[model samples]
Target: MDGTALLRWGRVCLDDLADRREEINALNVFPIADADTGTNLLATMRAAMAEVRTRGPVDALTTHDVAAAMARGATLGARGNSGIILSQVLRGIADAVRGGPLTALTLRDALRRASVLVRDALSEPIEGTILTVLDCAAASAASCRDASLADVALAAADGAAKALGDTPSQLGVLRAAGVVDAGARGLVVLLDALVSITLGEIPARPEYSPRASVAAQPVEDSGETGSAEPRFEVMYLLADTDADRIARLRARLAELGDSVVVVGDGEGRWSAHVHCADAGAAVEAGLAAGELSGIRIESFAQHGREMASGHPLAPVDSAGKLDGPADRGVLAVACGDDAAELFEEAGAVVLAGDDGVTAAELLAAIRAMPNREVLVLPNGALPAHDLVAVGVAARDAHRDVLLLPSASMVQGLAALAVHDRGRIAVDDAFAMSEAAATTRWGSLRAAGERALTMVGTCEVGDGLGLVGHEVVVIDHDVRAAGRTLLDRMLAFGGELVTLLMGAAARDGLAGELVAHIGESFPGVEVTVYSGGQHGDLVQIGVE
Candidate 1:
């Protein structure tokens, strides 16, 4: 319940998971024939562990803090379908704990809520998966009247183990494969660890033998890998809050994909997942439902080692260091002429996005790079598919790439300004992302449509002050609107202002803003340059 106990539980669970990972991976079948359930679960648990360790010192954290941190880490780093569901389930449990003392009643209630959350996250629930295993465990715990926490945990573990063994009889696919549900096996392992820790006993090591041995992919009649399921799996976090709107989104996504899942806090934030032939359409549905971020799209055929489209990790030598060639560089997507110049000046191979950019163009850009390991800054200025394509292409060529999510020119510029060519790629990426994060960027654009935005309705040609992807301010005058936006941004206590003037911007407007900034907010330096962006009269950034 507290931080110390939570840490102990985590160590036991993670160690058990690591030892049993391959066994779990071998048992994967239901939903899709992807043998990555173990990897996904491990990654999610690692993320949770890292979060707890990173939040200052472990000794000072409380039960509430650690629980919240684990949930947050799991939600952000969750991979694939099973991982996503597991994350929300952890979140549900965290919510139930909420800094309270860990007791039998609390544990029982948390387990019950975890199953409910997992069920809610799925569009169509199956009878014999990890969900069923967790529900059975929770039921066993709830039935124990006035039992100690240790006794309850042991009972839960026993129930989960039984349910896991019974999975083949409950699911036809699992029976056909002659294997138990991979995820259910993982849940049993976790509960077993919990029981061991609660009882202060050394956990029994699990045997790695699997009854059936086979790869995850299904083959077609032509002897190539194929599936009758959806071609692509798309996922992202959506921010909005209308119960009716969420219901609408659920219906729409169900129409678009079979494995549709839209679940999170009912308030305003939710994680959306769908598998469909059209990735773009699924994303558009989310956009119509709410604002979206952290977008990931994967080809079902190339499940890759992770089931999600992850690049193969760089090889580590006998010294346990990432072995790489000396030749390394940064490949940046430049949306404008000035942006290209800025990136080039910083030793990046710039791909100009003057016209529309495509996946093929991105691949060609990667091929053009002379470095073996390249830091990619797609800038989030182009379509998501293009960037994902470049990542896949880079992986195929065995080039190490670290893609930065620089969504605006200002963010890209911030990153470029901080990048050190001689430093390690990952370290430089962290520094650059930190620099980008410290700087808040926005644009002044004229609305072309009359629609209900998160900020409210906007008429045609209305001056829109945008921060990140959402419009935060609407006004009639461009110059005054820009100043108003600056006022709001400066209110957050920025040290300097960076302006990227558009072609449509007036000659003296940048100077005028600089002068105003100097007066309105003394000691705040202002710098400006022509951005040559396709739209938006002025782009602004604060650092």
Candidate 2:
């Protein structure tokens, strides 16, 4: 296949996985019942597709280039055990197509290489898991080497489906749970997506579900049939390491605990995962090997306890039940005193300062909070990687932290406006997230230097109006820029316009904008606040 075809395959895979993310998550009883297999897979695929899209235009890329990008992105973005294994599979396919087209023979070779690489990556490859399903697919692909690429993909998908169906018989955990292996089921979805792309039609597949006898059984505990599973799940990215050191790291992690997986991206970068009692030692072993980043250590014991109680939320204790009040806290990152006060008045624990809030500060703030469940609003100040790091660290410390994807301070306020302590944590989080997502946000800032933007050239002292990160309007007059921003934002249909005057905003700017909105877009309500935020002259949110 070509690069365009590969891109289509990635899109199809991502869409299919997105549709069945929660379903796949529900089948996660093996490894650990974190119920994030679907999330991990979706995240990994998204990272891959994102990288592919970044490689200039689709027409400019070759099959090898796209495959290599996929492998690299998957390696760097892989999460959990399943994501790591999936990375290896992508890497193998890339290797197979390095010097050839993705024909039936090369696809067969790709599957075979993937099986070997996956087995090697795992410290102890388990049956009835993704590994077994991959092996079955590879074998079937090998038998159809002389056929067309579509036929080979069909064989692979069929083999994976059969293996997934038999996973319960291979492992006691799945048998007890009366469900197919979650990771294997995810692989089948991927392979089916491949078949869809190759044949231009979706193949029929069995519904992935629990056996009839266990269909109604509640998941009280993780179906991990063992004396006692490891307490912690540690994962990290290791760089500047060699095969010898990776081997040693694997051996060391195996000594500490089980479920160890270390896979590389053909480059020096490697992703390591392990379930161990000594989380520190697991990380320390990687440190001895090379540099590390994205360090995440999760407690399975705490996770199990949480699962036993409920998936993500539970009823408050007797003292803080529906009749009584529960102390639900909101942690928001604000830029200045005005914004901080506004957040505090809205009942959020404000992390007020400059925009340079560190992960350490966020983690410390979360840990210091008395509430067990804390909602975090990063407010576009923190980077995505930093936000993820802080979330992992907070969870490691046993804090139930939910990071809302609020891109601006105004969006954070919009979310806070809908927060209700009376509702369950999950429902409250959903409501806040929905509010943040639906609000269209923009900002106005003075250009620091002359530069060419997506809109046009902007000189120093020019007012730049931006929606999200892209500058859409630039004008010499700040008020004109603000007017143009509102007009453009309102063109998309908004009933309410929320304006925050920044610390450096000119006097009467808010009133002028409100008047302009009233005259230009009648019936649109306007609310103004003194944000006192830095970097931007004004922040705007339309809902």
Candidate 3:
């Protein structure tokens, strides 16, 4: 297939996975229970798709160039362990077929190469991960040696689906949880999408609503007891050219923590994930290994509690019963005091969010509301597991919560601006979600440290301009970055622009941006507000 076809495949795969993200996320019990394999995979896939779009469909792009860009894009955008491994797999496939036509043989080799490459990236390849599903798919393709690419894809998808079913047999944790491996499930989903695309049709899969599958107090836990597991889970991307140094770093991290999996190549880029008592020390090891960025530290203890609960960590109001007829309202997770007030004034019950948000925090908001039908705007990006758990919990509370997947505060604002209280809950949710999605958003933030991003290496204090989670530009001046970001977002055309400046944003920055907006996009209306948020300089929304 050509670049455009590959881009189409990527987008289709990403969309299919997005629709089932929560279902896949619920199956995450193994691999440390961060509960975001689906989220990570989707994020990485989106990055790869974005890269292809950037190359342009009509551009005179070679297959090799398209492959290389997608692989590199996924590598930079990789999130959790699943994401990192998935990136390596895509890179491997690209490496195998970049130089030639994608015949059945090439497709077979690509699958084989992807499986092997991902295995090498891991310090210890697990038997029941997406890796196994990948290998199974490759083997299935081999069994159909002389088949067409479409036939091979179909076989691969079928094999992966069967392998996913057997994941519980390979991993005791999955067996205990009474579900297949979450990562494996996601891999199968992608493969099935590949089958659909190769056959030139997005097949309609049977509708399946997911319910929590974890049985409380599994048999495997009967006599199993342990000291407190690692207090923190730390992950980051490090850039180092020396293989020997990366090896030593792995050993050092293993000594400091448990469930350590540091993976990558000698090509100067690696991702390390570990559970440890001292998060600072884990990060320090990465610093010694190379320049590190995209640091994420989460409380394993907190995650464990949420997971063990098999429900919301904290239930909303006591007795869990709504006393009367169901009403409808809006719930928005706000990052700052001012933002929260704005949402509240807009008739939305505000929940505190950003890095500190938890499932309980979201549940609390749902419980606080007397309305039975609630439209929830998570407002900020959260790990898939947390969001899914909150959503499930909200449903359990007998509230019909329609979660509008707002990845940014600005998106949440757009949804709020269009929210119609007079409409039925489902109708309002439909309208609000559409507005939130149509609104293209960007943010300006200062880099936390020297790190490798999609744009390039960004030093501490460098301005990072992002569209969604992808960093599109890096500059020394935040205003310049903001201007560039605005221009990029406005490229598709917009009638309204919303600017929310954080607490540390310079007072005149908005004025400067507003002036530029007026000059560049004459008739577009601009609305500015003090978001009072930290970490980010400014957030922009376009509609």
* Model 1 residue 404 CA deviation in Å: 14
Model 2 misplaced regions, further than 4 Å: 1-228, 231-257, 276-304, 307-321, 383-386, 396-398
Q: Candidates 2 and 3: which is better by lDDT? A: 2
Predicted candidate 3 versus true structure: per-residue lDDT over 1-543, tens digit per residue = 665566666778888889889877777766666567788889988887666667765457766567767777777677777777777767766776667646677778888888877766555566876879989988998899778888998888888888887787887777777778788777777777777778875434333222345443323321111213567777877774377877887788777765566666324567787766666567667766775667777775645533543533223235333333236788888888998888888888887764567655676777688875778888775555456545544552245667887888889988888886555556568889898999898899988899999889999988899998899999988789888888998989999999998988987999999999999999999999889988778999999
Please say which candidate is ahead in TM-score: 2 or 3. Answer: 2
In the range 1-543, model 2's lDDT, one tens digit per residue, is 987888888899999999889888878877776788999999998888887877888898989889989998998888889999889888888999988668888899999999999999988777899999999999999988568999999999999999889898998778787788888888999999999988988888877866667656655444343214578888988787899999999988888877789999897789999887656567667766776788877777745646643544445755544444545799999998899999999999988757587666777888798997899999987777667656765653344778999989999999999999887677788999999999999999999999999988999999899999899999999899999999999999999999988999989888889999999999999999998888889999999
* TM-score leaderboard ranking: 1, 2, 3
The best candidate by lDDT is: 2
Cα distance off (Å), candidate 1, residue 174: 0.3
Stretches of candidate 3 off by over 4 Å are 56-58, 201-228, 265-267, 303-543
Candidate 3 root-mean-square deviation in Å: 14.6
Write down the TM-score of every candidate: 0.58, 0.58, 0.53
Tell me the tens digit of each residue's lDDT in model 1 across 280-349: 5676666667656777877766555332435455565675445664467888877678768877887788
**Model 1 clash tally?**
0
Model 2 scores worst on lDDT over the 10 consecutive residues at: 219-228
Please state the error at residue 216 of candidate 3 in Å.
6.1
271 in model 1: Cα distance from truth in Å?
A: 2.2
